[model samples]
Target: MRVFVAGATGVIGSRLVPLLLSTGHDVIGLARSQDAGAGLERLGADVVHADALDHAAMRHAVRVAAPDAVVHLLTAIPARIDPRRLSRDFAQTNRLRTQGTINLVDAAAQTGAKRVITLGSASVYEPNGPDPATEDVPFWHRPPKEFIPVLDALRELEALTAEAGGLVLRVGHLYGPGTIYARNGSFLHQVQSRNVPIVGQGTGTFSFTHIDDAARAIVAALETTADGALNVVDDEPAQVGEWLPVLADLLDVPPPVHIPVQMARSAFGSWGVAFMTELRGADNTNAKRVLDWSPKYPSWRQGFEAELAHPGSP
Candidate 1:
């Protein structure tokens, strides 16, 4: 299969490129910079220089690549993205999800692409909603105030992707060695350096996945021609309270000091506070059954420990 990957140098993209190459699939990755292209080149991928927002350029790039399967890995969040700007930057990110997705799907359709697989997020779900949200679970538009509009945009993006038989992957929070959350110690840095303080009871449940595992799921779905929304998460959902101190221990740092949610909200604002204080998790049954997938890491703790040992992490 010939695969075209947008954001081919990103956290998941970096891992994905090599996986596709090893699978004997020809890959053409979209690179926004020469440095980004370099990684793809080294990974044995043909590189296409084009931004996701530029539809005309993207159209040409896709046409030239003529991929049998188009994988949309494009996202605004980088390995070092600021947590404070999530709400502000996510509006444009939402545009990328809605409009950029439309562009990618349309371009794929024009190029006679067989399948389209795009990344989605579990953050759109409400804080403290369900234990494990399924593909059949109802997504509350009013929940997770900061990410609400973004979820709405995903709804829009999925509607468009559905028109062209593209698959929408609603994955949990991505934390791995190459990701912003892990790079340069990242959230792990804050924890190791005693920077990420605990809030309230810190019992809010959440989910996570390894970048490689995410790539595997995407590849599996593409290979099987699986369509619609699937939750690409781990075997178990973990709570902040339990995971934090464990993570701290792993980094040889002190256990985090707890602060009230109200106080933390006043400090980190609603966007940060919601994820830290409130929680949403996803189920992986559909992915296992349909995509024939299984996560290499069963939970965040296991994944992070391995990633922390990796060279890229601090």
Candidate 2:
């Protein structure tokens, strides 16, 4: 199979290219810079230089690749995000999710691609309520704030891909070498700096995924052509209390200071609080059953250790 990976320079894209190549697929990647193309070339992927937001360029690149499958990993995160403004801010990423997904899906159709697979987030689910949420759970029940626009874009992208052949994977809070999940720099960055405080008794249990697992599950869907939403996650679904001290321990930092849930809500708003302390974990039975995919790292602790060592796995 010939595969074209958009956003080939991203955290997942860098790892995904080699995985597709190892499987005997002729891989082509979208790169916007000479440096980005150089990296993809080193990984044995044919480079297609174009901006994903540029529909015409993206369409042309896809047509040129003439791929059997198209994987969408494009995001504006690298260009805009910094340590100062982290995941707490997501409006630009939201635009990339909604509008960028629409454009990429359209480009896939124009290129006559057979399958389309997108990287989605477990954050799409409501923060409170039942643990271990499934793909069939309703999405619009929550207020239209944090996860709605992104999931709405995902729904639109899925609808468009279904017209061809499509799979949308809702991945958990991402962790890996190059991602926000690894290193004390991300969530731990806040914790270490004492910028983060425990809210609501630290009761919310959230889903998380290793970066390699995320890249692999997405490509697995592309290879197998299994359609619909598959929750990509690790074996462990953790509560805030359970993971916080563990993470702080890993970084050799102090435990997060606790704050009242209402105070936290008033300070960060519902979306921000839910993201930091939420209880939505996604079930991965469908992905394991259909795509023959299982996470190499059973939990974030094991995954994070390996990730901090590798620096190249992301």
| Alpha-carbon TM-score of each model against the true structure | 0.92, 0.89
What shift in Å separates residue 250 of candidate 2 from its native position after superposition?
A: 0.7
Q: For model 1, how does the per-residue alpha-carbon lDDT over 1-314 read when each residue is reduced to its tens digit?
A: 99999878877888888888999999999988999888788878899898788889889999999999998877775434444566566777787888898889989999999999988876556556546777776666455456667668888888887888888888888877566557464666677678677788876677887888899998898778777889999988877888888878877778999988888887777767767766767888988999889999887777777766564542
CA lDDT, every prediction? 0.80, 0.73
Q: In candidate 2, what are the lDDT values of residues 1-314, reduced to their tens digit?
A: 88888877787887788888888889999888999899889988898887777778877888888888888887665432332234435555666666667777788788787888887766566557666877877664664355555556666666765665688888887776566555634655666777767777777677788767887887678657588778899878888877877777666678878888678877767755665566577778888999999999878778766765455443
lDDT of 1 at 103: 84
Clashes of 2: 0
Error of 2 at 173 (Å): 0.7
